[model samples]
Target: MENSIQSIPQNWYLILSSFMFCIGIMGVLFRRNAIIILMCIELMLNAVNLLLVSFSSYAGNAEGQVFVFFIMVVAAAEVAVGLALLVSIYRNIASTDINILSKMKW
Candidate 1:
């Protein structure tokens, strides 16, 4: 069991996480749609979660995994609230574009 775990290098995990986070950042910055941006944020969170799990396993400790759980909880709440807000905005404007959000004010 232990040898199976150690086969992959820690560097690969770091690289993969960094790549995921960068993609998320790019999506959030370049995408105009609210839903796509929200999904990107989720991607970023998952990348961090992956990194945390990898470190926890490599270190033979549970602390990083615990942090990942807390992050997951927060991410879930964020998605719930974010989607609700998006739905409300879409109903009012009939669109989900971020630039049009300026018109959201009464």
Candidate 2:
């Protein structure tokens, strides 16, 4: 069983991560909703985390996993701040559309 698991090619993981990253990029580029864009950004981050973990496992190293841990922490902080901003924007504008944010003035 272990052998079978180990027999999987690293390239497959790379390909999968690449596809996910591309999807995330598309979502961010095409979506007009602030929440959707944030979700896409999280998707992209997760894709990177997946790639890091796969490479770390393949290389028999712990560094990548440790980096992933820090990335997760940063991502969490980013989400908290981002969500707070979104809430404030929604409260002020009564909408979550990114396009409307351009008209925001001090």
Candidate 3:
């Protein structure tokens, strides 16, 4: 039974990742808050990481895992820069509304 369960093809992982990516895309497009959009982008990246790791483990390939490491580094940098920008925006405007930000002048 254990072997049978373990024999399942890895496409399910891909499907799950695709669904998560879609949800993140929707959230990013539909939500107005800057923080929420950033969170959504992170969610998408995590989903891709999950897919990469799953394929790497299943195929016994180290390259995918290596790519995941790079992706994590990029994600960390993105979060740091994004939060810094958000903080600066808040400092100048006092509101995080995306639409309202366009009206503000430096």
Report the Cα lDDT for candidate 3: 0.92
Which digits, one per residue and each the tens of the lDDT, describe model 2 over residues 12-32?
Answer: 999999999999999999999
Residue pairs whose backbone atoms clash in candidate 1? none
TM-scores of the candidates are 0.92, 0.92, 0.87
lDDT of 1 at 14: 98
Question: Which of 2 and 3 is ahead in lDDT?
Answer: 2
lDDT of 2 at 73: 100
Q: What lDDT is reached at residue 39 by model 3?
A: 98
lDDT measured at residue 102 in model 2 versus the true structure, 0 to 100: 81
**Distance (Å) between predicted and true CA of 19, model 1?**
0.2
**Across residues 1-106, which tens digit of lDDT does each residue of candidate 3 receive?**
6464277778888899999999999999999999999999999999999999998888778999999999999999999999999999999999788989775565
Candidate 1 Cα misplacement greater than 4 A, ranges? 103-106
lDDT by residue (31-63, candidate 1, tens digit) is: 999999999999999999999999999999999
Query: Each prediction's Cα lDDT score?
Result: 0.95, 0.95, 0.92
